[model samples]
Target: MESGQGLGELIPPLADSDYYLDHYDDLSCIITQGLSGKIIVNGQPYEEEMLALNNISLAELSNLINYMNSQWYPDKIEVNLNTIKAQLANCAD
Candidate 1:
């Protein structure tokens, strides 16, 4: 539930105000395909390549998403299996 702890200030924090507000929709892609280069989180820049987490099952991912949303965001966003599958299908390499 705690955010703002990256890899020695290299990688961006997974949860942040600007990130959850702006790139919330990209969560599926980021989880499936990983993210590289720089991204702005809470007005600060972070540069690193987060490894893909595609090995986990859809159920696990859905549960993780739900937990994260409940902990970080104001509104609850329940992620279903179908939604996760659909979003993952559209992920870019």
Candidate 2:
């Protein structure tokens, strides 16, 4: 989690509500199809290119997303298989 700490380039903190809240909806797409270019999280800019996890099956990806939401975001949001599927279907790959 502690990569640079207010110094240089940073990995968007998934545990921070500010970051998660803004990108949660598109998180699934980002995870599945990968993300490039620049993204602002909590006003800080990150230009990291996340590699797509397309090698995994839908069920595994769903489980990972669900686990992350439950752990990091708690009851704020929930991602089911259908939701992941829909997100993947709409992903620009």
Candidate 3:
């Protein structure tokens, strides 16, 4: 099922802001026990999206937080948006 119209057709690219580094640094410092993070999507604060992402069993949520924490890298300016899929793999089965 690899009918490639190119990946841009499936997922539009997001814009990058010059000030994004501040937020990226902020995210790396968040407390995993009760993460209170928000990411903007299409120019709006996306708490709903964040909530949906963490919607899972408690163990999985903890594991997901751990996975995210482990993945913080200052050198990687481009977010692997698909990395969420990789992090989910670390969640409790």
Candidate 4:
């Protein structure tokens, strides 16, 4: 996958059982996928903490990418950061 691709585009699809089998040991993946409604592992329902963690991960990833791009390509990075900040603010409400 390209570095510019979004998380949604980068994530691969997998069956619920298969996802559990592959990622049960990886708490980050399990929480992320579960919060995104992509997979249900071990019959466990998605919880607030999982969703929050997913959101934090996404936010951090976005910020990191934006920062990197900002150092290399200022204009595009500012635009992307503004857009992401707006989206995050909206999500807060």
Instruction: Give me the candidate number with maximum TM-score.
Output: 1
- Provide the TM-score for each candidate, comma-separated: 0.80, 0.77, 0.26, 0.25
lDDT of 1 by residue, 1-93 (tens): 266355546766556567865766667777777778887787788777789887888898888778778777748568799888887777765
Give the winner by lDDT: 1
Which of candidates 1 and 3 is the stronger one according to lDDT? 1
Q: How close is candidate 1 to the true structure, as a TM-score?
A: 0.80
| Per-candidate local distance difference test | 0.73, 0.71, 0.36, 0.41
Candidate 3 vs. true structure, TM-score: 0.26
What tens digits encode model 3's per-residue C-alpha lDDT throughout 1-73? Answer: 1331113323211223222334433332222222335544334443322223333554554454444434533
Q: What clash pairs does model 4 have?
A: none
RMSD of each: 2.2, 3.1, 11.0, 12.0
The local lDDT score (0 to 100) that residue 34 gets in candidate 2 is: 82
Error in Å for residue 63 of model 2? 1.3
Looking at model 1, the pairs that clash are none
Per candidate, the number of residue pairs that clash is 0, 0, 0, 0
lDDT of 2 by residue, 1-93 (tens): 433133356566666547667766676777777888998877888988878876888788878777777767677666678887787777666
lDDT of 3: 0.36
True-vs-predicted CA distance for residue 46, candidate 2, Å? 0.5
